[model samples]
Target: MFDKLTRTFSDVLRQVSGKSSISEKNIQDAVEEIKIALLEADVNLRVVRRFVNHTIEEARGEKVLRSVNPGQQFIKIVHDRMVNLLGSETEGLQLKGPDTLSPILFMGLQGSGKTTTCAKLALRLKKEGRKPLLVAADLVRPAAVKQLQLLGEQTGVPVFAVEGEKKPVKVVKQALSFAKKNSFNTMIVDTSGRMHLDDDLMKEIQEINSVLKPVEGLLVADAMTGQQAVEIAKEFNERVGITGVILSKFDSDTRGGAALSLKSVTKKPIKYVGVGEKIDELEQFHPDRMASRILGMGDVVSLVEKAQETIQEEEAEELQKKLQSSTFTLQDYLEQFTRIKKMGSLQSLVEMIPGMKGNIDEDALNSKEMKKEEAIILSMTLQERHNHRIIGPSRRKRIASGSGTSVFDVNRLLKKFDKMRLMMKKMTKNKKLQAQMLSQFNGNI
Candidate 1:
């Protein structure tokens, strides 16, 4: 989501990448550009200073200046330093064994998406084969408990809330007993939040934390808050200890100041990030992969992981066979759309592919166009989907009317599908051509 920062780094790299030699002045100029970019992106002033200083010190070293490929060496130094500034390594949640009860207390300010993050984490743990119970201990906010209950139902995770309980500590205690009795291995307590950090709010959270003795006290900070989120996290960590941080609304946070600055300022890792509103949109943070993304290097590992999670092995094999046989139909095309939608938005997917960042029009990949194409495909009869060649002029007009599109639109889609199928047939039959294309793709990556 660091679009501006990515562009800046990409521009600096392109300017210096092909040079046979680079001087100290060149290194300083590049680092200066990076410093301005980070500051404009709202990164912490101290963090930006440290990152710039470290990068310069490393890039100006004799080992880098005299390397066989000095320009590439300089780029590597920048990438490595950025990775280190981001955290150096991925840190996962420290949880007890599945046999033991693991209480995870969520604390944040109001409107930070803390309640939703509770449900999202529970769903993730549930998918990971943990029996998670959502405790609606947020008695302050109106409808907070009901909101958690609704989220629990959507996620298929049970919720524990005492109807008349006013004290969050009492509710949490009862929730622990209920979880133990019900064999719930993971307990996620949604604690009350305030408009701002107040004494009463801190006291309530502290009491609940003491009662729960949680294995993880995660602070759900809003990424959109930028450095303010970092300040809030630092305060939370100081007042009531937090094991890690969770940046919510990360997908919408294009500047990415909070994510880049939180770990550095708080000395706590970002265990997870809230990418979207869906229960399944939570993603574990990987510092190396994130650094790659920020530098416009792409995150192929995360892309592959998302594919593995969304696409079934059997279905993928069947699609491959159909492509090889030249039997891929409109039905298969529509199914592919559904699978990609499940994986994520098309723009997000494009950003994950190696060498594809900032290369496509964002508006062209918006959901409206995809929905229109899906409508056109769904308006077709089952036989028409299986045998698109059978749709003549009359059928085309009817399909267009049914889909609320023009006949030209239908024809254009058919033309594109035919060309794609022909390309697949050619690639399947010609191993030499396929290898050449594969080599080209690998070169770009």
Candidate 2:
């Protein structure tokens, strides 16, 4: 998601990549470049100053000048500073009620996706085997209640709401009582959001806090807002108190300034990031992996975790077997697309990969193109899906017509799939070929 920042760091690293020694002049030049990059990405001036200063001090103190790979060493120093800015480490949610029901208060501004994030968090907790009840206390917005209800329904969690309790505190208190009666071990209170920070809003939230006594108070913010997101987090923390920050719309941010600045400005750990609109799109925020990503290195660990969470164990196992055996086919292709669709948008998936972040058309992946592709595949019969060779010109026309597409569209997918399968098959047969493929995949020269 941090395409601009990632590109900036990669370019800076490139300037030092092949150097055998670093001079003071060169280091100063690089630091100046970093300052501009950070500023361009909307990083706070104070943060940028500290970052460049720390990087220079560390670069000199570590004797990067004498190192054989001075450029790499310099980049490492910058990477470390970025990690510090983005929170030194990940933080876990608090569940401290005798291993029973624990209350968590969700707070944010309107249009911050607070309600969606609440359901995503509950789904995350449920994945960890924690039974969480979604309490829809945003009674101010009519659609808010319905949105939470749909999320709960999709995630198979219970949504607790009263018919006429207008006050958020009253709704939460009653929701908690209902949860306790139903044996729910965890209650997530989704509170209402306001257009701007106000005294009345703070009072209502404080009153809700007094009644529910939430162990965790999370502020959901849109990552696209950049430094404004961080400012919002600070204001919320100062007024209502927040335990952590949840960065939503992460899939849309290219500058990534918000993620880098929020934790440092607010002095709160980022617990999770919302990658997509799906309930399962929430990813636990990890500093080290995020650092790697900012350095233009792929996050393989997070990628695997995402796959495991989204794909069924048996299905993934089968895919692995097929990969090893060179049995990849159109059927396997369709299965992979389905799995990826469940995970999130294809553009977000591309961004998570090592070097394809800025190159992928995010809108295309998340748009009707993806749906069109799926429809084209689904229009094929079982035999056609398994064996692409059987789809003759007449059948191609029929399938295209059935799927509301042109023959060219179907041909494009098949051509790409064939090339990919052939390349994978060749790589499967030779370890060195596979390594070379991986190297090329990572954008190495």
Candidate with best TM-score: 1
TM-score on alpha carbons, each prediction:
0.97, 0.90
After superposition, candidate 1 runs with Cα above 4 Å error: 429-445
Query: In model 2, what is the error at residue 189, expressed in angstroms?
Result: 1.0
Give the whole-model CA lDDT for all candidates, comma-separated: 0.89, 0.83
Off by over 4 Å in 2: 312-317, 320-326, 359-375, 406-413, 436-445
- State each candidate's clash count: 0, 1
RMSD after Cα superposition, model 2 = 2.9
Q: Write the per-residue lDDT of candidate 2 for residues 1-445, one digit (tens) a residue.
A: 7677777777777788788888998899888988888898888888888888899898887569888778777877887888898888878987955457899999998888999999999998887888899998888777899899999999999999887777788788888888888788889999888988788778888888889988899999988888888888998898889999999988885587888788778889999999877678888999878887877766767777778877878876777678777667777787777777776666556656876665555665665876777888899999898888888999999989999999999998788878888777666667898787677755421
